[model samples]
Target: MKNSPTAGYHTKSAVLFVVFNRPETTKRVFEAIRIAQPKRLYIVADGPRRDYPGDVEQCKQTRQILSLIDWDCEVKTLLREENAGCKNGVSSAINWFFEQEEEGIILEDDCLPANSFFKFCDTLLEKYRYDTRIRHITGCNLQFGKKWGDASYYFSNRTHVWGWASWRRVWNDYDVNLTKYDGTEVKAQLKNIYNDDFVADAWTNIFNELKAGKINSWAYPLDFCNFFNNGLVIIPNENLVTNIGFKAGATHTVDEESSYANIPLIEIGEITDPVFFVPQKQADLSIINRDFNIEQRRVKHNAWHRKLKRWIKSKLK
Candidate 1:
């Protein structure tokens, strides 16, 4: 795959633009969308939260940027009157998107995507539109510097939603509350898929928060949907979307202590198909350890190592 000109490149799939109260970031993301020039654009904006002082004006300005559709495109919008927060707000917006579209690319106000990313997603969306096993098409590779397999993309069971796409068939199965996973089935499935010792505790906390309305994320439940249905996600070999909204006002990115901010987007030219269509188990495990369970695994390993060292020293004494 070599880098080429994207001058007149336009996406065949419609795009769903999710926005909120960041005009600057929205403007930049809107510029990226402008380049892709999608045929149909769906804009979803959550209203300003009452507690955030300047949210009203900021939300207004962000919506203004989102509406500057100068290119030849059909635009639809769902602008809320009151803030629904990220959990309900984003889920509801996506629900609105799939209600009209069979499949489409989804971009947040802060996800700066490379021009090539649109093509990548559009190609996969059409290719796997009917494949129930292939559930997600994402534009992120959080392996840090590690590349997986010998193809342009690899299959995994994780949900990397920095920039992604999905079909109405799969989105219809997306459960925000994951009410189906309320029993021992989640524990069994989590362990089987993730192969993590502490996946139970880690996901238990997340499910608890989701049930109690303690967190403001929709991505978590989407991950549950991916796992629950045994769906494989197609992740690019090179990163195509760079998340640029990890600043002070960000809902989750700022609070995540994440190392995934502002990654340089790589151009994925001449997309190649993988020889094997199976999910790379090692890649999936790597994502869990490096991203989800890093802190917990580190603490456990350190305590075990310390206890082992103490036992050896006492025996010698």
Candidate 2:
């Protein structure tokens, strides 16, 4: 297995990098991967949007940065010719990743990982390759200064996909369309898991909107996929990834000023395996509550913000 979470260690598992029209962020994230120096690098890029005038140029620039691979790595690319947006673009990229790799690390243009994040996943991915209960190994920890146990990691029901690793076994059952489980019943699932009515209802509404085509996200389905299979996600005690794309152009994380934006990256120390395999119910509840509050406020505020912008533009016209 790869050495403990330390600097200057090469990553063993294949790394999948997903990019779109953000060359600046993509380059930064790519530099981190370059340091890790994974033996195999798989990149997937979504096509430029026809509606967005500069999307073609930006997408081209982002894809161009990917060809700067200088290490002795086997690199593969899946560049789309048509726009697939957030839902399809990302989920399909992951699907493409698993089609060749049994398991690997996945990062987006925005999810910048600490150098140790690669070893953290590489070691655990090998340790639990056959463990069905552990479906996810993610670098995202949203506890925000809260401590759960003495272990270096804790289990959570929430699937934080910012920078994560998973197996094909888990992805094989994934459905971005939520075809298996009825999206209307997500309230009950959340209620049972979190035991918080407000959190459950909030997530249920989000899932409902996602089903109704009002939203575009590949994460909720991934969460549901693990939830459906009674799988638990491994969250490191140290938050290893700092999401840097919480800007105006980002699809969900549009509020760059939000508290969750660009959280300080913390490299994990010696791994302390948690004794129990049960999900941290309290952590899950805290996550749902925090996420719900932030998302609800953002949605409400953004709606009004857009309307005001449109009104101002109409007056100017």
lDDT of 1 by residue, 1-317 (tens): 42322365689999999999999989988888888888899999999898887999998898896546777778898999899989899899999999999999999998999999999998888888788889999898888778887789999988889999999999999888877767556676678777665765677667778877787789999988888888899999899999989876678788444688888888977988998878887877776676666567769888999999999999999
lDDT of each: 0.85, 0.87
Worst 10 residues of 1 by lDDT: 1-10
Model 2: how large is the Cα RMSD against the reference? Answer: 8.9
lDDT digits (tens) for residues 81-130 of candidate 2: 88998998999999999999999999999999998899899989998999
Stretches of candidate 2 exceeding 4 Å from the true structure: 1-7, 183-185, 294-317
TM-score for each model = 0.90, 0.88
Question: Per-candidate RMSD vs. true structure?
Answer: 4.5, 8.9
